[model samples]
Target: MTLLVIGGSGFLGREVARQAGRSVTTHFRAGGPGRRLDVRDRAAVLRLVEELRPDVVVNTAYVQADWVTTAEGAMHVAAAAAATGARLVHVSTDLVFSGRDVTYDETSVPDPVTPYGAAKAAAETAIKGLVADAVVARTSLILGDGDSGHEKFVHALAAGTASGGLYTDTVRCPVHVTDLAAALLELAGSTYAGIAHVAGADALSRHELGMLIARRDGLDEAALPTARQGSGPLDVRLDGTRTQARLRTRLRGAREFLAR
Candidate 1:
């Protein structure tokens, strides 16, 4: 399949590419080439898509720094996807929801809390308006190598424990980058159009997850503080029943992901 992976160099994007490459070889078909194009630039995005003429365009580009960046970024990407008539699989976040105590499904209305959540929710709106054959995959706290976004959580535990303690109240359901990437590829190929959830199997608090990581890595989990708290939403677990039904590869939990 001819595919265009935006933000192809990022943690999840790279894994999607890797899986695509391997899938192609295993299936005895050639995977399409990759291009590192920023989704925020309208002209550049349109030009790249027009030139590549890919059958599927997967957007993994987004910024957490500000709402403007994400809103603009996703706008151009959706536009490019519409212009090219390509199936667009846009990666969204679970934060788009209000982070209410209850677990969210695809049907749940998004009531974003933080600026990041609001930005992603806005982007979803733009994508839906622009493309008819678009699928928005809403994932949560992606965990892979510490080099990825997981570094923030990893470091937080290390630093918090070194100083005094860590927050046990905040909770999240973090999925493996590879698993999320696989689901993205499936979404790109399928006719499933709309927002879908993709997250880890179990819900875990920050401290519990940290302890698991510490124990697995032979770190001092006991030294970590039993009480740590942060601002914003907690317990933003997603119900990925739809994703689980569609994806071929088995979705893994944080423990299985860390073990890998």
Candidate 2:
């Protein structure tokens, strides 16, 4: 199948392309055999969509550098998906949740805390109604050998270990990029649609994840901090019941990601 991966040149996007390329004939922009088309350019996007007529359009292109530009950019992409009959897999984030002490479900109401999350939420809204065949995978902190996807916890924990201090709080479910990539492909091909939370098997605090990485890397685990009061999200675990039942590959845990 000809799968069109938007932002296939980026970190997570590249991983998605790599995973998808292993199974199907794929194409991309900015170096991949396809024409360079920005999502914001409505005319160019429409033209590219009509030309490609891809079976699946997995949108991993997110311009997090500038919030205003980011939201504007996704509008046309959503429109293009609606214009064409392509099955759209619009990647989203966990930050759309308020990070309350509760686990968010696919049906949970969104309360984005940051501008980045807000933009993604807006994009989700813009496209959900536009396309009938679509799946929104709301993922969490993506980790792997490649780009960490703005993973402050990893950096902070490593920095703390290097500096002899780390945060005791700040919890998150750090999913591996490769695993996430697989899940994206699965969602694109699956019959299930709507917002599905594809994340790590276990949600650990920043300190805990840092400790795992440190120990795995043969560094001093003691150098990392432990969970203390007033850290980060005491609980960022999203209910993955629906995802678990649907996806063939079970979502991996944070420790599994660290081992990789």
Candidate 3:
């Protein structure tokens, strides 16, 4: 099957493309292994989708600070997927929640408290409206790979090269990029629809997660300073019990993966 992965240069998008078997990947500014197509341009997205007519389109592109790229850009991709009748697997975030609830499940409605969250939430809504059968997979902090931003931050913090403390109150279900990518690809071929939580099995604070990563990498765990969150959501935990039951990929916890 021909798969199209948007944001192929990104951490998760790169993994998605790598495991996609037969796939066409796209990048924005970064030099990608495949084509260069900005998701912000509706015509370009439509043109690529029309030309490829891929069986599946996994949109992993999003700019946290840009509304056009995060929200409107998603609309363009969704429209193209709709036009081509391709199965879509959209990557959403746990930030979509406001931490008003203790934990969020597939049935929970988005109540975002931040602009980034709002953008991601908006993108989720648009994709659902365009592709009725699409999988709106909401995930948490993606790690596991040492190359991921979070992992790199942990390494920098340990080396006393980075500023800022890991928030002790900021809770998240950090997932392995490999597991998340594998799960997303499996959902691409499955008939399951609607929002699905694809995250780690363990719920942890930012500081605690950093400690795990530090220990795994043989870094000075004590060097990683800790602090409380300043604003926004604090304890937004995504419960993936339902989605995990349906997937073949084992969504290992941070404690498990980092321990290795």
Candidate 4:
């Protein structure tokens, strides 16, 4: 199947493109290993989609601090994908939920407390309105390899280069990048539409996860500073039971993957 991966140079996007193999066309913003396609440019996105006419378009392009790129750019991509009848799989994050709930499912109403989360929530809403057959796969902290910024931060913290302490109260289901990519690829060919929670099986606190990473990487866990998250709801653990039941690919937790 012909596949188009947006933001292919990104951490999760790169993994998706790699796993997708030869039939995939990758698009990146600025400079990367793929054709330059800015998602922010609606006309450019439309032109590219019309020209390629890929069977599926997987959008993993988003800048956490940039609302225009994260929210409006996603809408542009979704619009083009809809116009070309391409199946769209948009990657989202668990930050969309306000940590008040214990666990979130596909049915959970997004009450984002942070700006990044709000932007993602807006993108999801726009995508659903634009593409009827789109799959909005929301995940948690992505961990795998040493490429992701999160992983880099963890490493820096372990090495004493980063000053901030890991939060013990903040909780998340950190999914491996490879597992998430595989699941997204599987969903790209399926008829499943709307929101789906695709995350790890275990819910862990930031400090707990840090300790696990430290133990796995042979770092001193005691050296890693730990603190409780501030008053704002920090628990953003996702309920991946729906995703687990839908796909044959198993989503392992941080502890499970690190043990390997």
Candidate 5:
């Protein structure tokens, strides 16, 4: 199957490309094994999808603060996929939830607090409306290979190179990038459409997850500073029980994946 990975230069997108049989990737500026294309451009997106005619298109491109890139960009990709009749597996985020104390399932409504969350929530809505057969795989904090922002922050904090402590109150299901990517690819190959929670099996606070990373990397976990998040939702966790039963790939938790 020919797979076209939008944002192929990204952390998760790169993995999707690497694990696929035949894949053509697209990048904004990460400089990887794909052509440079911005998802924000509707015409360019349509042209590329039309030219490739990929069987599946996984869009992983997003800018937290940029609505054009996150929400509108998803719309552009969804529209392109609809136009070309390509199966789309758009990567979304659990941040779409407002961090209510309750666990959210695939059917939960989005009530984002932060701008980034709002943007991602918007993307999810756009995709659902545009593509009837698209899979909106909502994942959480993606960590892997010591290159993710979360892992890098842990390293910087341990080395005294970063400011601000990890948030103790804010919580999420941190999935390994490889696992999330594999789950996404699996969804791409399947006929399953609509919302699927593809996050880690465990829900942990920022500080707790940092401690795990620090411990795994032989750093002093206790030395990692911690702080409470000032505003917005806290302890928002995705309940992937239903989604897990449908998947073959196991979504390992932070404690399991980060254990030494």
Candidate 6:
């Protein structure tokens, strides 16, 4: 199948493109191994989608702190893909939900407390409205290959370059990037639309995850500072039961992936 991957240079996006192999055509904004196409430019996105007419468009493009790039850009990509009759698979995050809820499922309504979360939730809403058959994969902290932002933070802390304490109460389901990419590719081929919680099987706290990483990497776990999460909603653990039931691939937990 002909596939198009937006933001193919990102941590998760890069993995998706790599796993997709030769039939995939990738797009990047500033710098990457693919053609430069800004998702923020609606006309550009439309023109590219129309020209390529890919069977599926997987949009993983996102700027860390830019709301417009995260939300509006996603809408543009989804709309263009929909117009071209391309199956869209948009990668999302668990931050969309407020920490008030103990755990979130695929059916959970988004009540984002943070700006990033709100933007992602908005993007999800826009994609659903624009693409009827789009698959919105809401995943959690992606950890693998020590290249993701989360891993960089852990590495910085371990190397004494960073000095922030990790939250003991802040909970999340950290999935391996490889597993998440594989799942997204599988979902891309299916007709499953709407939200799917594609995350790790085990829920862990930030401090706990730090310790696990430190232990796995032969770093001093005790050197890592620890603190309780603030009053804001800290628990964003996603329920991956629905994803597991839908896909043949098993979403392994952090413990399993990091237990080298």
Error of 2 at 105 (Å): 1.0
Query: Against the true structure, what is each candidate's TM-score?
Result: 0.87, 0.84, 0.97, 0.97, 0.96, 0.97
- The better candidate by TM-score, 1 or 4, is 4
Candidate 1 ranges with C-alpha deviation above 4 Å: 22-36, 151-166
Q: Note the Cα lDDT for every prediction shown.
A: 0.75, 0.73, 0.90, 0.90, 0.88, 0.89
* lDDT for model 3: 0.90
**Tens digit of lDDT per residue, candidate 5, span 23-106?**
555555357656888888899999988998989889989988899999999999999999999999998888888876459999
Q: How does model 2 fare in lDDT?
A: 0.73
Candidate 2 is scored at a TM of 0.84
Q: RMSD of each candidate?
A: 4.7, 3.5, 1.1, 1.1, 1.2, 1.1
Better of 2 and 3 by lDDT: 3
Residue 95 lDDT (model 5): 82
Q: State each candidate's clash count.
A: 3, 1, 0, 0, 0, 0
lDDT of 4: 0.90
lDDT of 6 by residue, 1-260 (tens): 89999999888888999999998998899897789988889999999999999999999999859998999999999999888999999999898989888799999999998888999999999998999889999998899966777777888887889978889988999999999999999999987888888999999998888888888888888778887868665988899798889998789999999885
lDDT of 4 by residue, 156-236 (tens): 998889989899889999999999999999999888988888999999998888888777778877888888878665888
Which lDDT tens digits does candidate 3 get at residues 78-160? 99999999988899999999998969999999999999999999999998888899999999999956988998998998898
Give the higher-TM-score candidate: 2 or 4: 4
Least well predicted 10-residue stretch by lDDT in candidate 1: 23-32
